[model samples]
Target: MSSSPAKPTSQHTSDHFRFHRPLAHLSGPFGNDSFALRAEAFARFFGTPLFLGAQTLIVVLWVGCNMAGLVHFDLYPFILLNLAFSLQSAYAAPLILLAQTRQAARDKAHADADAQHREALAVANETRLAAAALNSQQMLTLLQQNTELTEMTRQLTERIERLTVEMHERFVIHGSAP
Candidate 1:
């Protein structure tokens, strides 16, 4: 059985940003390739506690091993360790900058979309207000027409009663006097 996708309700449709067409492209800065994705992930991991802790542990072990004479790969100056740190910084600075640039672009896109959504809402509210005002005026006019009709009916009823009394006096009282 082929099932169609469920239709979005008003709640889902009202999310202007979620359905915004322009911001869809801005959702990812790194092109979908594995390398670009990996680079972005690596940049994100740089400031994490896990990354910092692992690096600290490795550095301590390296220094401890060298000082204790258990490994003499790079001795007093720790020149090799310093070189490794330099290489890491070289790669890290650019990747971090790239991530920051991507984030800035996404932020700008969201901000623009939000501004457009607000404008649309304001226009809709104004239209609704104008329609409500027009409806109120129409209702007022109908109430006035009803009031005028009721007054005319009351006057007609009073005039009929007066005419019936005058006719009764002319026929009954005049005929009795004769």
Candidate 2:
């Protein structure tokens, strides 16, 4: 239940084992809640196939328009288009890096949580096993005690029966019959 993983001890030995695989939480740092999350979302959008297709289409249109002489915006050297791509890369790099940093933080948090969970489980299992061992030992001791008590009771019963028979014989020998 603690926020961090517990260290292994001699009593709780299962803590030495690892059984959990922590997965990344990709809930996006900038969701609908804040601008930071939104910016991260927009930054990640560029990595998708949809963004690739859209960019390819725009490039084709730009080339076709220039070759057909329909637009004089970006001529032979395509200086304006090249400048636009440079500008896009300049902004894209940092935004993508920011989102990546957020993702890394989320992953670390998830990993820490999962480690704590595994520690709890291992401790529970070790406790159960220890309890079972103690119960087994107590049961054996009880059985042994029971056997000794039963033997003692039998001996006492046989002694009582012998004493009763002897007393009866002595009474018959020393007194008149009824």
Candidate 3:
């Protein structure tokens, strides 16, 4: 087995993967907490009875003026209404874009934090594994040393016994001659 790190080969390349993918082309930028907050704000602003009453008042005033023949079809009231709608659309688009940008930034921050946490966890696990390997190696070395000491003790005991036996035989042989 090779000790080198694994490298991606041609077989691992994805046909569908694009290196030049645009950020604007990706979806789900508005699918976050800030976007939800902005949507809720929009709903709250537009869904109020006060807003409805104001709209009704404007429509009634326009119709009343039209019926009374005080305002012409090509003049003031219709133009004002069109201007208001255009302004609302323009402002709403930017506000929604701002909310989506904020949400995307928040999501990116969270993703970065998660990546950092995973990296820390990987480092901790590697440290634990290295410590375990070191402990195992130390234990094996100690056991080998212990076995060698026991064998040395046994050999020393055998040599002591043989020397004692030789000394006894010499004593017996000399005493019998005397």
Writing each residue's lDDT as its tens digit, candidate 2 over 27-72 gives 6664445887668767979899999999999988998899899988
Candidate of highest TM-score:
1
| lDDT at residue 89 of model 3 (Cα atoms) | 80
lDDT of 3 by residue, 1-178 (tens): 7699778898887854332233333333444478655764774466589988988898788777876888777354567768877987887776667666766776676666667767988999999999999999999999999999999999999999999888778778566442
- TM-score-superior candidate, 2 or 3: 2
For model 3, the stretches where C-alpha displacement exceeds 4 angstroms are 1-40, 43-87, 164-178
lDDT-based ranking, best first? Answer: 1, 2, 3
TM-score of each: 0.81, 0.74, 0.49
Backbone clashes under 3 angstroms, per model: 0, 2, 0
Q: Which ten residues in a row have the lowest lDDT in candidate 2?
A: 16-25
lDDT of 3 at 29: 42
lDDT of each: 0.89, 0.81, 0.72
Top candidate when judged by lDDT against the true structure = 1
**Candidate 2 residue 130 C-alpha distance from true site, Å:** 2.0
Superposition error at 98 for model 2 (Å): 1.5
* Residue-wise C-alpha lDDT for candidate 1, range 59-139, written one tens digit per residue: 999999999999999897999999999999999999999889989988887888889888998999999999999999999
Every model: Cα RMSD to truth:
5.9, 10.4, 13.0
